[model samples]
Target: MLPQAAQLLNKIIKLDFQPDIVTYGAIFKGLCRIGDNASALTLLTKMHSAAHCKPNLVIYNTIIDSLCKDSLLQQAMDLFSAIKTDGIQPDVVTYNTLIRGFYNSGCREEAKGVLTEMLKSNITPDVTTFSILVDMFCKDGNVKEAQATLQLMTRKGVTPNIFTYNALLDGYCLRGQMEDAEKLLDIMTQNGCEPNVVMALLEDMEDKGIRPDIVTYNILMDSLCEAGQLEDAAKFFSDLVLKGLQPSLKTYNILVKGFCKKGLMNEADDVLRKMEKDGCLSEDIFLVMTFPRHYTTAIL
Candidate 1:
């Protein structure tokens, strides 16, 4: 659709109308969207050579982001240098694109090197830079490194947000290190960061006038179920309805499975009946509850 728009724009331009850099940039963006960076680069060249049109920061940034996403880091770097030579300084977005690309390529040091370059170039590392590093490190199972990066961000005067804390929390949880996860939660509370799980963070959210959503309720319910606290799960499930949030099918299934796991067949049947009454029952739930022994113990 965008390419066709570009063709129409060209037709309009030929009818005694002139298209400016923004107009050409839009077309360049459309070309890049179709995974035609080669053509986008060619268009950039033509724009640069044209007497009336020249590429701007947005155009350069778009191409650089596209190149990095495509794993053409060398090409992206070359374009980065070219953009700098054209008197357009690379912004944080440019560095971020390169950092993500290098990290994805397993070039950890190279990825960090971008941060160093940013500091040397007098560019401040924003929350996004720290968040990206923390997320990447956590995903790579380097939770300790992620924690260290979080500390670094704090020391550098960049307050850790909920996402930053959540990444570390998820890392600790993934490793089954609940002790560390709880400690991190304490730190988050101390730092006045909040997420919605009906725990301490729930109070924080309410104090800030932010109501807990369905996803928040689901997380709390699932956590309670996993911890063998079916009563707490049930209470939270009721609170979810009281809060005017619709429970998803997964929410019902979690509660039913929790009851079934504890051999409370009657309660499980009750929940199943409630699900049917809500018009949310599906065949999937029947299968999930039918073969409990196989479902619980079967290995992929």
Candidate 2:
């Protein structure tokens, strides 16, 4: 279907019918899905030259996503530079893509720099911006940076939501700072913010006032166990029970794995048994049960 679409695009190009930004973005996105990033990048250049039409934020985002997936982090940044040189002002999506791209490419400083640039451009950072930055900083063993970004969010009047807390908690847990993560959870509750950052950001602006969400509880619960903080994990689970939110099977599996990591077979067994009793053990979890010293040591 993509090849046919590309052929159709080429035919359109030949007859002097310039495809709109959407058309180019569709073809560019298709190329990304098929793992032909190099061709996609080249085609992007071709589109620029042939039509002299600047690609929109969507097309740039597609290319940046493809670049990040292809491990071309530097190239992605280079394109970010080109985006401006080519007279394209990046939107919020572009900033998130570049921030994540720099993050995945092991360019932490540059990634943070992109965030600063976004601020200078007056492009308001969204939850995704803070979430990805938190994840990147935390994964890179920069827990303080993660915390600092949260502070920045506060100064900017972007209240920390669950994703913000979950991300910070995850970072703390990853760095063996379970106590700090728990403290963050406490702060989240005290601040009257929801647990998940994504929903928190949306609910504030979503015309309809549906504020009920469960993603933050799930992330924090899962992250706790994944980081081997079983006691805290269980505490969060208990909290979930109190809140009347049914713990999904995925949640139970996370606790079990956490117990298993701490070599507490008894606790793991008990958690699994309870999950079965609750009739929530039907789903499969891709549990990375093998505890590694570090999931990534590439963070510079």
Top model by TM-score, which number? Answer: 1
Model 1: residue 171 alpha-carbon error in angstroms? 2.6
TM-score of every prediction relative to native: 0.61, 0.59
Error of 2 at 239 (Å): 11
lDDT of 2 at 185: 52
Runs in model 2 deviating more than 4 A are 190-300
Q: What would the per-residue lDDT of candidate 1 be over residues 112-231, giving only the tens digit for each residue? A: 888789879888787878888998888889998998999898889998776677667667766766667656664554554432342655455456455556665666666677667898
lDDT of candidates 1 onward, in order: 0.76, 0.70
Q: What is the lDDT of candidate 2?
A: 0.70
- Please report, as a residue range, the 10-residue window in candidate 1 with the lowest summed lDDT: 189-198
**For model 2, what is the error of residue 278's alpha carbon versus the real structure, in angstroms, after optimal superposition?**
24
Question: Each candidate's root-mean-square deviation in Å?
Answer: 14.3, 16.2
Clashing pairs in 1: none
